[model samples]
Each structure stands twice: as C-alpha cells, then as structure tokens.
Target: MNAKELHDKTPDQLREELASLKKESFNLRFQQATGQLENAAKIRAARRNAARVKTVLNQKAAAAATDAE
Candidate 1:
C-alpha cells in the first residue's frame, strides 16, 4: 500500500492497517528465524508499509492538533 491510499483512510482504519502490518512483520521474522522464509523481500515490504501507515497517522494527528489550536 502507498501513502496516497492510506491518506484517504480515517485514523481508525489506518490504525487497523498498521496493526495487521505489524503482525505480518512479526510472522515474517519468525519464519526467517526458523529458516523457512522463502522470500526475504516481504520483510522489507512489510516494514516499509508499516512506516508509511505510521507517517500518515502522524500527519493526521499533527493536522488535528493544528486545527485544534
């Protein structure tokens, strides 16, 4: 997923997506530790996706705070 797609989602939705991405990242790590991981690229993709979600969430929070002020 990209920032543009995440930007359209509400904070709650973005939070949910972030949760799922984190779960996937954990699973990928576990597979790697067990030497069962077939594709290492997934780990990088998951990390980047999680970061993108976080960035969007932070941006939303900052915007809300600014509006409140």
Candidate 2:
C-alpha cells in the first residue's frame, strides 16, 4: 500500500505480494472494461503499489550485488 508497509515486509512476503498485486491489477482492468469498476483512483493505487514492490525488490537485489563485490 505504502513504502513503509512495503519495506517492512520480508523479501519472500514482498515477492508474494507483488505477484498478488499484479494479478489484482489485471482483474481491475477487466472490471473496468466490463463496467464494474467504480473508483478510477483504485487503478492508480494498484499501479503505485506495484511500483513500490518493484523498487523494494531492486533495492534488495542491488544490496546483495554490492555485498558480493
């Protein structure tokens, strides 16, 4: 939902959540097309959450890479 929550999750949990968010985004789009979605802001929120997940994953990967060097 937010960076604080995202950052607090363990790496494995973050990965799981990322996958779930992506799936939800896809469903949201489907609902939008079918005229079931009410709030447009939800799509934006989902997208932002997806990005937050990605940023955290990248940070972890980069940290690991730096440690190897």
Candidate 3:
C-alpha cells in the first residue's frame, strides 16, 4: 500500500491496517525464530508498511489538532 492509498482512508481504517501489519510482523518474527521464514524480505516490508501507516496516522492527528486550534 502507498501513502496515497492510505491518505484516502479514515483514521479508524488506518488504525485497523496498522494493527494487521503489526500482527503480520509478529508472525514473521516467530517464523524467523523457528527457522521457518522463507522470505526475510517480508519482515522488512512489513516494518516499512507499519511505519508508513504510523506516519499517516500522525499526520492525520496533527491535522486534526491544528483544525481544533
């Protein structure tokens, strides 16, 4: 998912996406620990995706705060 796609989603939707990404990250880590992870690249991708979601969520929160002010 790209920033443009994430930007179109509401905060609630973003939160849900973040949660799922985190869950996936956890599973990836577990697989790695068990020496079953086939693709290490997925871990990096999941981390980056989570970061993107967090960045967007922060942007939305800041915008809301500014609007409130």
Which number leads on TM-score?
A: 3
**TM-score for each prediction?**
0.97, 0.90, 0.98
Question: Candidate 2 overall Cα lDDT vs. reference?
Answer: 0.90
Q: Which residue pairs collide, candidate 3?
A: none
Tens-place lDDT digits, model 2, residues 1-69: 678888788889999998999999999999999999999788889999999999998898898899999
Q: How does residue 50 of candidate 3 score in lDDT?
A: 100
Candidate 3's C-alpha runs over 4 A off are none
* Residue range 2-34, candidate 3, lDDT tens digits: 999999999999999999999999999999999
| Ranked candidates, highest TM-score first | 3, 1, 2
Q: For candidate 1, lDDT tens digit of each residue in 1-69? A: 778999999999999999999999999999999999999999999999999999999999999999999
The clash numbers for all candidates, in the given order, read 0, 0, 0
- Candidate 2 Cα outliers beyond 4 Å, as residue runs: none
Ranking by lDDT: 3, 1, 2
Highest lDDT against the true fold, candidate? 3
Instruction: State the TM-score for model 2.
Output: 0.90
Which candidate, 2 or 3, has the higher TM-score? 3
